[model samples]
Structure formats: C-alpha cells, structure tokens
Target: MKAKPAKESLTIMNELVLPNDTNPLNNLMGGRLLHMMDIAAGIAAQKHSNRVVVTASVDNVSFKNPIGLGDVVTINAQVTRAFSTSMEVRMDVWGENIPNGTRFKSNEAYYTFVAVDQTGRPIPVPEVIAETEDEKKFYDGALRRRQLRLILAGKMKPDEATELKALFLSEE
Candidate 1:
C-alpha cells in the first residue's frame, strides 16, 4: 500500500467583506464569518490530504470584533497537527482597513477535519512539519487541543479541563 502524503504547511484565503455579509448592525454575521472559515479550512484540508475531506467539528469560534462593510477579511489557515484520521486546522481572521491601510485581527478559531476515502471512511493523515517558530507555536496549540479533546471524549482526565472549556467559551 502507498503511504499517505505529507500534510500541508500553509494556506491563506481572503475576500473583501461586502454589505451582504454584514448584519443589521453593519457587522459581519456570525454565520457568514463561520462559512468563510469553513471554506478556508476545507481548502487547507484538501491541500494537505490530496483527497476529499470533511469538517467534523469546530472546537471554539470566537468573534472579537465586528467586521464593517468594505473591510477586507483574510482567513489564514495552517495544519497544526495530525493523527491517524484527523487533522487540526487553526484559522485566524483579519480585517483590513481600506482607508487607514491597517489590518486588525477580528477573530480566530480552530477546526477539526477528517480525511475520508471515496467510500467516506476515515483514513490516515500524514505528519505535519514545523518549518518555523510560528509553525511550532501552532503545533503546540494543536497538541493542547488534542489533549482537551481527549479529556472531553473520556480518554483522559485533565485537572484544568473545566477551566479550559470556560476560557474557550469566554472568548465567544
């Protein structure tokens, strides 16, 4: 049997925020923002897995700032870690100011995706390589996330599991 390909190192997807993307308050709708993140995550997964992949879960998505109309939103994604069949993708959302030529972080999230074969069965994912310090940080965060998932799934007991969940929810 052929071995799986190595995980993707980096991915970035950007689009200009339009009026339709925002809500009545002129802020980007939460669901629309999540949709953008999902698209970015799916692209990153396909690039890494070289096959069809599906989003299994979004761990914690928090919107820190409201994206106003005309602001360009950029979603950056990277593979933090990988297991036998699942991979963790970290996505950061940034807003670019059209007038000031500045960019602000509007939100961030971590999503989990599973690589699947044509039959929709989970498959092994290749190892993720850390090529730089930032990559290392992302990997470390992914490690923590994996541990948290284990705790939630009853695979492990972490003393700070409750604290972790609280922190994650507070961001939202």
Candidate 2:
C-alpha cells in the first residue's frame, strides 16, 4: 500500500450552537458535539483511505467545558495512524465565543474507522506518514491503543498485547 502524509487527511468542521443545537440549559448538547466530531473524523478517514469508511469504534470522549448558545464550535481531525484496513483519527474540539473573540479547547477523542468496498468488505488503506513529532507520537501509540481496545472487546488476549506489555511491563 502507498504511504500518505498524515496532514493529507486533515479535516475541519465548524458549527454554530443555535438554540436548536443546545439543551434546555442553553449549552450545546453532548450528542450534537459527538455528531460533529464523527463527521469530521469520517471525512479525514475517507480522505486518507480514498475508500468508503465506516466507524469501527470511538474512545475517550469527554467534555472539559460546556459550549453555550451563540458559540462557534470547531472540530479538527487528522489521521494519527493507519493499519491494514483501519485508521485512527484524532479529533480536537474548540469552542469560540464570537462576541468575546476568544476560543478554548473543549475536548478531544479518538475514532477508529475501517475502509470498505462497495460490497461492504474490508479493504486495505494507505499507511500514514507522520512528519511532525506529535504525529509520530500518536502513530507510535496506536498499536498500544489498538491492543487495549481489542482486549476490552474480547477480540484479543491481554497476554498477546506485546505493544502494551512493553509499555507498562518493561523492566526499564
């Protein structure tokens, strides 16, 4: 498979928190933010894989701050790493106060997606080339994250997770 720079898969989406998008407390609904993040991550995966992609899993989604009505929410996503047929997309969310001209980070999460053919069969995707230090760190940790997720899903054995083992069980 060909290798592609991680930046090639970057996707950004912006949304305004209208009354319809918020809860009764006048804060943006968590589900709405999640939907936005999913859309952004999906676009990134599709751009990187050049194939139809479907969400396989999501992890560590937590909101650090509330987004109020009239705020602009921006979600940024990028491919952190790519496996045989799946990719890990990292999404960062920010809330911008238009009136105050201030923006603050709200949350971040990781999403996994698998490329599929028209027949809905899994298909291989290009490898992600991490050019920046941060990208490289995420790319390196992808294996550990995959192992943990698989273990949690009962798809893999804890003893077989070499990447995770070395991470926490290493003598050094």
Candidate 3:
C-alpha cells in the first residue's frame, strides 16, 4: 500500500453545546464530548486508510476544562502513525465561548482504529509519513504508546515490548 502524509488525514469537527448536551451544571457532558471526539477521530482514520474503520481502543482522556452550555466545541484529529492494519489518531478538543472571546483546551486523547473490509475483518492500511516536527514526534512515540496499550490489555507481554523497554534501558 502507498504511504500517505499525516496531514492528509487531518479532520476538524465542530459542535455547539446545547441544553440537551449539557449536565445540570450547564456544562457539556463528558460522554457527549467523547462522542464527538470519536467521530472526529474516526473520520481522520478513514481518510488515512480509505477503508471503513472501527475504534480499537481509547487512551486515557482527561477533562482539563468544563465547556459551558453555550460554548462551541472544536475537535481536531489527525492520524499520527499507522501500524499494520491499525492506526493511531490524536485528538485535541477545545471549547470557545464566542461571546466572551475565550477559548480553552478541554482535553486530548489518542484513539486506535483498525481498518476493516466488507466482512469486518481487519485490512491493511497505508502507512503515515510525518511531515512536521510535531507529527514526527507523535509518529515516533506511537510505538511506545501502542506497546503500553497492548500490555494493559494483556495482548502483549512486557518482555516483548522492545520499544517501551528501550526507553528505560541504558546503553553501556
């Protein structure tokens, strides 16, 4: 498969927080934000793979700020790296109060997705080539993050995570 530039998969999605999307405190609900993030990340993964994709895993998501009911939520997603049939997508979310002209980062998360065919079987996807320094950094760190994810899910043994081990190993 041909390799694709990471920027080609960039996806930006926006949503206006409403009464039904918020909690009693008039803040956007976490689940609602996560839903939007998933959609943004899914679109990015599909753009990178050119195939239907399914969410494989979601990394730790921390809510850094509460989005008010009238805030506009923006989610920026991009494919950071591709590994075989799966790719990692990084999503940054921000909430802006247009009236107040204030914006704050709501959260950031890494979501893993696997390309699938008609039968829902995993299919190979194109590799991602980093073109910017930030993209390069995310691409390089993806392996370590994947290893940790696998370890936490019991899909990979600790000893088999060479990339993660290298981080703590010293060269004599």
Candidate 4:
C-alpha cells in the first residue's frame, strides 16, 4: 500500500461554546468536547485512508482548563500512524477567548480508528509517512503506544511489546 504523509490527513474543527452545550456554570461539557474530538479524529483517519472509519478506542482525556461559554474551541487531529487496519489519530484541544484573542492549550487525546469496508469489516490502510520533525516524533512513539494498547486489551502479550519493553527495561 502507498504511504500517505501525516500532513495530508490533518483536520481541524472549531466550535463556539454555547449555553446548550455547557453546564450551569457556563463551562463546556466534557462529553460534548469529546464528541467534537471524535468527529475531528474520524475525519483525519478517513482523509488518511480514504475509507469508512470507526472509532476503536480513545485514550485518557485530561481537561486542564474550563472553557467558558462563547469561547471558541478548536480541535486539531492528524493521523500519526497507520497500522495494519487501524490508524492512530493524535488530537489536541485549544480554548480561545475571542474577545481577548487569547488561546490556551486545554488537553490532548489519542484516538484509534479502524478503516472498514461497506460490510463493516476491517480493512488494511495505507501507511502514514512523517515529513516534519513533530510528525516524526509522533510516528516514532506510535509503535510503543500501539503495543501498550494491544497488551492492555489482551490481544498481545507483554513479551511481544518489544518497542515498549526496550523503553522501560534495561538490558542485562
């Protein structure tokens, strides 16, 4: 399969925090933000594979800042790696105060998506190539992340996580 650059799959989604999507305190709801992140990640995955995709898993989300109503929330996503049938999408969230024109980093998340056929069966996807320094760092870390995910899911043994093992365990 041909390799696609990470930049080609980059996607950004912006939303204005509104009363309907916020809590009584006027802060954006966590679930609503997660929904936006998922949509953005899905778009990045599809852009990379050009196939129907589904969210397989999402890593922990740490909400650092409370986004107030009227703040613009921006979610950025990019395909960091394309595994056999799954792609890892790295997402970042930013809260921008329009009046002050100031933006602050809120949180980051990693989403795994699987490309599927019309029958909803998983299918192979094109590999992702890292072109820039940041992309390369993400690409390099993807293997370890994938291994940890598989191990935690019981789909792979801890011994098979060579990338992760090498990072934490010292040689004799």
Candidate 5:
C-alpha cells in the first residue's frame, strides 16, 4: 500500500465514564467499558469511511487495570485498515483521576466494523494509508489481529491460525 500523509486517526471519547457505571466493587464495569470502546471505534470508522458503521467482531479485549468510578476514562480508537466493506479499529482505554490528575492505562482491544449504506447493507470503504513508522507498525499489527479474527470466525483452521500467529509474532 502507498503511504499517505500521516493523519490523525485516534478518536478519543472523553467524559463518558460516570458514577453509576460501576460494579459492586466500585470499579467501572467491564461491560460498560466495552460499550464505550465500541462507541469510540464506531466514531473512528465513521471518520475514516464517512459512512454508517456497525460492529462486526471484537477480536481481543483484555482489562489491564481497574477503572474506578468518577475517573475520566478515555477511549482512544483508530482505523487501522479498510477493505471493501469492513474496517479494523484498535482501541486503548485509560483512566485519569480527576482530583489527583493521575492517568493510568486500563485496557486495550481491537474490533472490526462493516461500513453500511443508508439501507443498512454493506458498502465500499476508503483506502487505508499508513504514513509514518508508527502508523505502519500499527497496520501490520492489525493484520495479525485480523488473522486471529478469521480463526475465531471459523473461516480458518486452528493450525493455520497458529502458523500465521507465529510468523507475525516472530519479529517481536
């Protein structure tokens, strides 16, 4: 793919976390955090494709730290690639203590979404252009993540997926 001028991809959702969005332990619920992630991803897809987007699959979502109530939880999302009708979005979550001004990484995940027309049918999406080294690295990582997604969707066998994973992860 030809590199295009580096553009801003991250769409940060600010102030989405609230007091009632917590669990019994007073931490932000995983489900709630997931919902916010999805929203941030949709916004990124929409910005990239300029079309209505719907979530197709969430590849991997792992919580790294607890998100406490009243913290400013930021959901940062970006479009890593786009096919004819689908795009991959990678997201990271961070929690900030409003009072102490401390920020901590909370979680991260990657999701796929399909761009749709007004009729709710799949449509063409824009090309993915990776400019800087960081953007290129992000795109390459997204490819491996997509392979895992194909395995999860039953389109690829476990052995093949494992092989692809090994090759993709070899550089690391």
Candidate 6:
C-alpha cells in the first residue's frame, strides 16, 4: 500500500468540560481527559489504517496544567508512525477559558493502536510519510519509543533495541 502523509490522519476533537466531568477540585478529571484522548487518537489511527483499530497501549500521560470546569478542551491527534499492523498516535491537549481568553496546554500522550480485521486479528496498515519538520522528528523518534515500550512490556530484549541503543550511545 502507498504511504499516506501524516496530516492525512490528523484528528481534532473538542469538548466542553462540565461539572460532571470535573473532580472535587473542579478540574477536569484525568480519566475523562484520557477517555477523550483515546477516542481522538483512535480516530486518527483508523484514518491512517483505513481499518477498525483497537487501543493496544497508552504511554505515560502527564497532566501539565489543570483544565478548569467550563473550559473548552481541544485534543489534536495524529498518526506519528505506522508499523506492520500498528500505529503510534501522538495527542496534544489544550484547555481554553474563552471568557478570560486564556489557553494552555493541559496534557500530552502517545497511544498505540492495532488495526484489526473482521475476526479481530491484526491487519496490515499503510505506512506514514513525514513531510514536515515536526512530522519528521516525531516519525524518527517513534522507533526509539517503540523499542522502549517493547522492552518494558517484555516483548523485546534490551540488547535488540538498536534504535534506542543508538539514541543513548550517540555522542552529540
């Protein structure tokens, strides 16, 4: 299959953080934000793969800023890279308070998704082309990140992570 540009899988989702979605401190709950991110990332992965996709793993998600209640939450997701049957999606979340005209980055995360067939088996997905500088940076970093993930999951031996080894051993 022909490789698709990373932008082709870009997805943007917005949500209004209401009281129900907030915690006792009135900030948007972490779980709620994660749920939204997962949906947005899943959509991006599906767009890239052109097949049903399921969440395989979620990398560490760090909440940088608090999203207050009534704030507008915007999530931008894009497929950073595609492996044999899986894709890595990068998501950046922002919180906007329209009344005060303030906007801040709230969270960022990486999610892995596997394309699936009718029988729920993994299916091959199209590769991703990095056209822009930022895309190229993320695309190049994906392999190192994937190697670390596999190592942590016990799926790959540490010695076999050539990308990660190169990254750590390279003299800047």
- Residue 167's lDDT in candidate 2: 73
lDDT of 1 at 90: 85
lDDT of 2 at 87: 95
Model 3 lDDT per residue over 1-172, tens place: 9999999999999999999999999999999998999999999999999999999999999999999998999999999999999999999999999999999999999999999999999999999999999999999999999999999999999999999999999999
Q: Which ten residues in a row are the worst by lDDT in model 4?
A: 162-171
- Which segments of candidate 4 are over 4 A away from where they belong? none
Measured over all alpha carbons after superposition, the RMSD of each candidate to the real structure, in angstroms, is 5.8, 0.9, 0.7, 1.0, 3.2, 1.1
Winning model by lDDT: 3
TM accuracy, model 4: 0.97
**TM-score sort, best first:** 3, 6, 2, 4, 5, 1
lDDT against the true structure, per candidate, is 0.80, 0.95, 0.98, 0.95, 0.81, 0.97
TM-score result, candidate 6: 0.98
Candidate 1 residues lying further than 4 Å off, grouped into runs, are: 1-7, 153-172
Please identify model 3 stretches exceeding 4 Å from their true place: none
| Cα lDDT for residue 61, candidate 4 | 93
Best by TM-score: 3
**TM-score preference between candidates 2 and 3, better one:** 3
TM-score per candidate, chains pooled: 0.82, 0.97, 0.98, 0.97, 0.86, 0.98
Predicted structure 2, TM vs. truth = 0.97
Tell how far residue 9 is off in model 5, in angstroms: 3.6
How does residue 134 of candidate 5 score in lDDT?
A: 71
- Clashes per model (N, Cα, C within 3 A): 0, 0, 0, 0, 0, 0
Clashing residue pairs in candidate 2 are none
Stretches of model 5 off by over 4 angstroms after superposition: 1-8, 158-172
lDDT of 2 by residue, 1-172 (tens): 7899999999999999999999999999999998899899999999999999999999979999999999999999999999999999999899999899999999999999999999999999999999999999999999999999899999999999999888777575
